[model samples]
Target: NKVSGSNAYVKSCRRDGVTRWSDGNTVSGCDGGEAFVCNSQMPWAINDQLAYGFAAASIPGLTEQQRCCACYKLDFTSGPVVGKSIIVQVVNSGPDVNPNQFDLQIPGGGVGIRNACSSQWNAPSDGWGQRYGGVSSRQDCYSLPAAIRDGCLFRFDWFKGADNPTMVYSKVTCPAELVARTECSRSD
Candidate 1:
C-alpha cells in the first residue's frame, strides 16, 4: 500500500486523441492509449534540451489503489537520447501500456522544448526501435528546437516506492547505472 504513489490526485488529462502535443503541458488520467515515440537530431549540438511528451492510461486495476506516479529517471536507451537523462511525469493512467501524452517538465536543460505537435505516429526504430518506422500523424519531432534533436529517443521509468528497500519493480531494470537511473523524494 505504501509504494508512495503521489498524494496528488490522478485525473484524466484532456483527450486530444493523438492530438496532444506541446511543452510544459499538464496531463493526467488519460485513458487514451497513444504512445511516446523516439525522436532525434544529430549529436554534437551544444544546446541539447528537448521536452519530449507522453501520456498513459493506468492499468485499470492498479489505478484505484495507486495514488500517484513519479517519473524518477529516464534513459535514452534507443535513439539519440541514449546515455542521457531527463525529467517527466505520468500524465495519465490508461486502458493499457501506451500513454495519451506527456508533459515534459524540463526545458532547455536536457531535451529542450518540444512544441505542440501530434502524438500519432509510428514507434521509434532507432533508440529501442519500434513496431513501425518514424511515421507520425503529428508534426515532425525534428522541427523542434536544436536541443531535442541532439538526444531524441528515450524510455522513461515511472515508479513509486517499494514496500521494502531491498525489493524492486519486476519490469524496471534491476540496478542503477545498468539501465535506468533512479531518484527519490528524499533526494528532492
Candidate 2:
C-alpha cells in the first residue's frame, strides 16, 4: 500500500494490561471463540522467550484470518529514521488507526523500549535498537526482504495495498526453533 513513511508509527504489544489482548488469542483469529496462543505469547517470545512485531488498525482488504501473522517490511526515508528498515508482523488490530498507518512493535519498530509491551524475550531497551515516529512520511513496500534471492530461508512477498493479503507473510513466521514456543505459525 505504499505507506507514506510519514504515516507510520511505533506501537508495542504486551501480554499485560486490561485493554491489551493476549498474544495467544490475538494471532489465532479466533473466529470460533477459540484462542490459539494468539495473545498468550509475544511475537519474539519462545515459550516466554522475547520476540518482536508490530500492529495495525486495518489492512487493505484482508479478513481477520488473513491479518494474523502478516508481515511487512518498512523502510524509513526521512527524519532520524532514514536508511533503516525492519520487518514486522500483524499481532493486533487497531480500530483507531488511519489508513496506510502502522503501529510497530517498540523492539523491531526502531522505537526504544519503554516497558509498554511484554518483556518476555529481552529488555525494553533491546527494542529494534531504535525508534521511528507517529508522523507522516514515505516508505517503499515489498512482500520480500531485501536480497531474498541470496538467502537460504524461504521468502514471502507482499505489496503495500494488496487484496486479501495472506497469513504467509514474510516477517510473521517464527524460525523453526522458535515456533514451538511462540504463536507465530511457520509459513514454510
Candidate 3:
C-alpha cells in the first residue's frame, strides 16, 4: 500500500480549542470538532478522535492530500530516530510553518518531548514535552488509534466540492517489513 509523496521535516505540536471571535483553549478533545476549523464560514468540523496521532497544519501543496485527516508515513533519515517510520494524521494547518514541513503531535509522534500540549489534553502521565525545533524525516503511513479502533462512527455530509472526501485519508497499516526493521513504536 505504498503511495508516492514528497519528503518533509516533522515537528511536534498541540491541539487547541478555538472560537470565531477569540482563540479559545481546551485541554481535552476538540469541543465538537469545529475547534480545528480555520474559517468560521465553513460548515464542516474535524472530528478529533485521533488527536494523538494527527498532524498539525503545514503549507499547502507539499502533498496532494496534506489537508485534514491526510495520513503520511514519516521515515526518519537521521538522529536516534533513523530507521524508524511512523504514520501521522493531519489535523491542523499553520501559516508560519514552511512547505515540506509537517508539525507532528508532540510526544504522540514519538519524536520530541510533549509540552506544547496540556495535561488535560493528550500529554502522557509521565509529563515530558518536546523542546526540539524539528525532527528529520523522509517521505511515506496507517492504523487508527484506540478511539477510532473502538468503533467510532462518522457521517460526512457531502457538498459539491467534496467529490473525493473519503479518499483524502490513507487508512493502510505500516508495512510489516518497515515495522520489523525497527524497535520504535508509535507513542500515544
Candidate whose TM-score is highest: 2
Candidate 2 residues lying further than 4 Å off, grouped into runs, are 1-52, 107-181, 186-188
Q: What are the per-residue Cα lDDT tens digits for candidate 1 across 1-188?
A: 12244333222212332232342234322213432322321112222442223323233344523413444334434344444443333433432333322223211112212212233222122211212222121234354344443333221212111111121111222222211211211111
In model 3, the worst 10-residue window by lDDT is 155-164
C-alpha RMSD for every candidate: 12.8, 14.6, 16.8
TM-score preference between candidates 1 and 2, better one: 2
The full ranking of all candidates by TM-score, starting with the best, is 2, 3, 1
Q: Residue 183 of candidate 2: its Cα lDDT?
A: 33
The CA lDDT at 149 in model 1 is 33
Give the better candidate number (1 or 3) by lDDT: 3
Residue 181 error, candidate 3, Å: 26
- Those runs of model 3 whose alpha carbons end farther than 4 Å from true positions after fitting are 1-52, 59-66, 107-188
**Model 3: per-residue Cα lDDT over 29-143, one tens digit each:** 2333323322111122222222123345564455433344345655545444344344555544543445656654432223233332233244343322223432112110012
The regions of model 1 sitting more than 4 angstroms off are 1-5, 10-54, 57-67, 98-188
Tell me the tens digit of each residue's lDDT in model 2 across 66-85: 55555665554544334434
Model 2: lDDT of residue 134: 15
